[model samples]
Target: MTSAYWPLADLRIRSGPLELRPPVPAEYEVLADAAAREPHAHPRIPFLEHTADTPLRRGRRTLQWLWSDQGTWRPDQWSLTLAVFDQGQLVGVQNVRAAEFARTREVRTGVWVFQDRRGQGIGAHSRRALLHLIFDGLGARRAQYRAAASNQASLALARSLGYAEDLAPLTADDTVRHFSLTADCWRTRTDPVSTHVTGLAPALFMFGIGHE
Candidate 1:
């Protein structure tokens, strides 16, 4: 079980008060609990199952996407979905994903924090830590944010991180507001928080980082 293919299981990203790592089997149940407690932000996203439904189904739905994403991954086009933990509590999940990333030098991320976990700076630095993994760890030239126009929380977080506006389109009536951050711009930001990574070298190679 030890090979270059193992970054999905081993990568870790950490900030002052947050940590990101792929969850094990036991942790998935904890993620389910976090999901049961969360008030999902946008229920319109086709792929997401609504958490406000039945209690029994809530936990089932919460674990489905992660397991499915794991099953569908490929190095050329895949999402590194990490469980977000604060101190020791599972609070949310974060994803850094791409297609033909070695050639494109571009990546996009998705994040979610539970209802109770909102309002702290977790959302900001969590994404920041992912950006660092993209730009600094994986040699990305830029990263994109396609936020729901109706999701003021996501839009505000993107703005606070110094992302610039870009044009994008989401599903019908679900307006997609776009934003982007370049490697250079990422460097100049006043360092609201910094990130450190471990077990990322293998992940970088899986991403075709140095091969390009």
Candidate 2:
């Protein structure tokens, strides 16, 4: 499972009881199927499941999107869509993305946990793993998150993680709330979730950063 050409495939992050790693093409269908089962998990999210389409079609669209995301990665702008697993079982997907990372050192993240697994704290563990990857492993200065104002669960999670409202420009949709956490806030936090990241040293270049 080693990728000589794309070391990102080797990246792994562990937090609590979860493991987050880069998704392989063969597992795209599994991710899509998970999403298909909970199409309306977040009504405002721009996933294909929101459309009035068959599950198969929605899954197909999800596959295409995942493929496109991996294919379009670049140093200046890229998205790392990691497949989340709990004790070796596919649970969902978590995405952490950045633009002009070399200069801004900021990243944004998104996640989709299946409806059946919503209340079990899986999302929190998944996000803690991702935050560790960006702030600790990648040396990110800030991490941002946005959720529809109506999505109380997501907003509550952001607040719980010590994220504060950010005065960034409003999106076309005013319903989305923005929050950001600075590296100082993250590092000095009293309640830290233990996390470990591996295989990232080899993929540093792909993320537009060098070993510090």
Candidate 3:
């Protein structure tokens, strides 16, 4: 479906200099170009071997999973895939998922920034935006995040956002750290600063996560 008819046309979240919005079908080329330009810096899973350099053939396979039927549209599952924009340019992608969402009321989040965009607090801003939409807009009870032990930045971001670290297996190169944050914890923290989002509730639920 065209983005206009895809249901999340107006869905957006802004945090200071960042703006998170659903990708329009017209944006597929933009995303593809971005993916092709810098194919080494964007890692989808911290512990997985899915790097930007994983061949367009392999990349296409991954994209299919994210954009196809087996992807984000199941009734009990939802995914919000956001195009992270900084000053009007698509710099990265952020994904939030909820399985059995309507019943579980919980979501998990993951994000990646372009190589040149790293270390600028954009990751933090993008994450906070999703958290706001989940906790404030969707009434989610909790949000979970996992970071590879080697990814100090992600681990740090999770901690900064008040996610309590959970005990998990720590291995040589596959260490995974799980963290979670609740609505009450988020409310007690300072609200994220944004300028693009207003009435995010209706748009949030209708969009069903992955498209936006």
lDDT of 2 by residue, 31-90 (tens): 778767765646534464364667776677778879878899998899888989999888
Error of 2 at 204 (Å): 0.5
Model 1 C-alpha lDDT per residue in residues 1-212, reported as the tens digit of each score: 23454655778888988889888878888777766655553543322445447655666776786787777777688877788889978888888888999899899878878778889878887888888888888888889877778788889999998899765445454467878899999988766667899887655656766531
> Scored by CA lDDT, what does every candidate get?
0.77, 0.82, 0.71
Error of 2 at 120 (Å): 0.5
Ordering by TM-score: 2, 1, 3
Location of the lowest summed lDDT over 10 successive residues in candidate 2 = 40-49
A best-first ranking of the candidates according to their lDDT comes to 2, 1, 3
Q: Candidate 2: which pairs clash?
A: none
Compared with the true structure, the alpha-carbon lDDT of candidate 1 equals: 0.77
User: Candidate 3's residue-wise lDDT over 92-175, tens digit each?
Assistant: 878887787767888889887776888998888888888887887778889988887778888899998899987753433356
Q: Quote the positional error of residue 183 for candidate 1 in Å.
A: 1.5
Give the top-scoring candidate (TM-score): 2
lDDT-wise, the better of 1 and 3 is 1
